[model samples]
Target: MMKTTSIIASLLILSATTFAQSWTVDKVHSRLGYGVTHMGISESEGSFKDYTAKITSSKEDFSDAVVELTANVASINTENEQRDGHLKSPDFFDAAKYPTLTFKSTSFKKVGDKQYKVTGDLTLHGVTKPVTLDVVLNGTTTNPMSKKTVAGFKITGTIKRADFGVAAGMPTAMLGDEVAIRANTEFIKD
Candidate 1:
């Protein structure tokens, strides 16, 4: 009877694994971006040129998924030349000092059929902090261009820029200490 029970347990575990869906970001349709108040009247927009993301989800539920992201700090892009240079300098991101920004999932809970609250540790500019993202699972579909099954999601939230050791000069009249960030990505099965 013990041997029979062990065999049944093994079968259940295998079945659970088989039903899970795992995917990696499809760079062509994925985007990582952020917006910050500039001069208190305007907003500054920027995005990282290089990033990698992965998702391991169970088609059965949103709570049964893991999300991860890694971004290259040097990939920061804003339109201007001088400002971008300054941002990359020691006064701000100091990309030379910290080359990568990473995030690993700590929890993923469902808020709706396609909405989720994802909490994780975000490490940026040499600082690590917990952050929560309001994520919307845009559902899954087949991409004609890539000829692959893909899942899309829109993840957004804000983090205190200062908390990430990115606090430089925040001119209240121009820019503030808080920054708004948004990331949208589509993951494809590997």
Candidate 2:
């Protein structure tokens, strides 16, 4: 009886795994970038150099999917070393204390033919807040060499730095409060 139960359990696990499609972020072909107004004159853009993302879904349309991601806070680069260092300090991201920023989706709702409203909890600088992103499915294709199915997406959102406890002493005239986020990512079926 014990052997029979174990065999049944194994089959159940295998069946569940077979039905859920898993996708891993193709980091080399993906980017999570951010832009903000600097000095009320120009926009400063940057991107995290290291990050990881995973997606699991049971629906072909991906409306029932779940997405999770983590970005290394220390990987921030803005084309200026001094400014990058400042962003890593306690006054900013506090990279030494909080080395990673993370997000986990609570819901993925289809809004249009290829558009979605993704609501998730974003944690940064020791703070967690609920935010919604406008996401567009850029379609999917199969790689010739690996023959793996690849999916593309464009996600856009905004978060106030002060709300995430990332506010420094910079005046409003010097820096904008809202950080505009834009990410273009490709995921490969695993």
Candidate 3:
């Protein structure tokens, strides 16, 4: 009886570990970008230079994946020093008060082939709201140099700055209320 129990316990442990897989972002190959209309004429683009993201899943297709991300608000870079500084001020993200913005997925549902709808709670500027983003699995492959399994994903969505009280007082004419998000990320299995 004791030997049989030990064998069963070992199998259970092996199965549990085998099923749950974790992946970490390959930061060098990833980008978290955003865009906003400027003066109703052109678009201004920016990106957070510092952030961390992870993916956890138990299924091969990633149908049961959970994603989490955190970005430093002070790392906003628009290529212009003055604009970047202004964005970190109270008029926008208020980086001093709210140093980080985060997202935790509530659901990751496969909508079609290699496509999914990810719904999550986004916390920014001291406010939290549910936002849905569209995600496409670009591809998955084994890296020749690293010999590690990697997955590529593209995510796109829009969120209203007012919804998170970011630049609440700014007029839509000067800076569009809607902010467009585009993220291309590569995750390597651990």
> What clash pairs does model 1 have?
39-174, 39-175, 40-174
Which scores greater on lDDT, model 2 or model 3? 3
Q: Which candidate is the best by TM-score?
A: 3
Candidate 1 overall lDDT versus native: 0.85
What's model 1's lDDT at 93? 90
lDDT of 3 by residue, 1-190 (tens): 9999999999998997789989999989999999999899999999999999999998888888999999999999999999999999999999999999999999999999999999999999999999999999998999999999999999999999999999988899999999999999999999
Task: Give the local distance difference test score of model 2.
Answer: 0.92
After best superposition, candidate 1 residue 142: deviation in angstroms?
Answer: 1.2
Question: If both were scored by lDDT, which would come out higher, candidate 1 or candidate 2?
Answer: 2
List per-prediction Cα lDDT, in the order shown.
Answer: 0.85, 0.92, 0.96
Model 2 reaches what TM-score against the true structure? 0.90
Q: Pick the candidate with the highest lDDT.
A: 3
- Model 2, residue pairs in steric clash: none
Off by over 4 Å in 1: 169-172
By TM-score, highest first, what's the ranking? Answer: 3, 1, 2
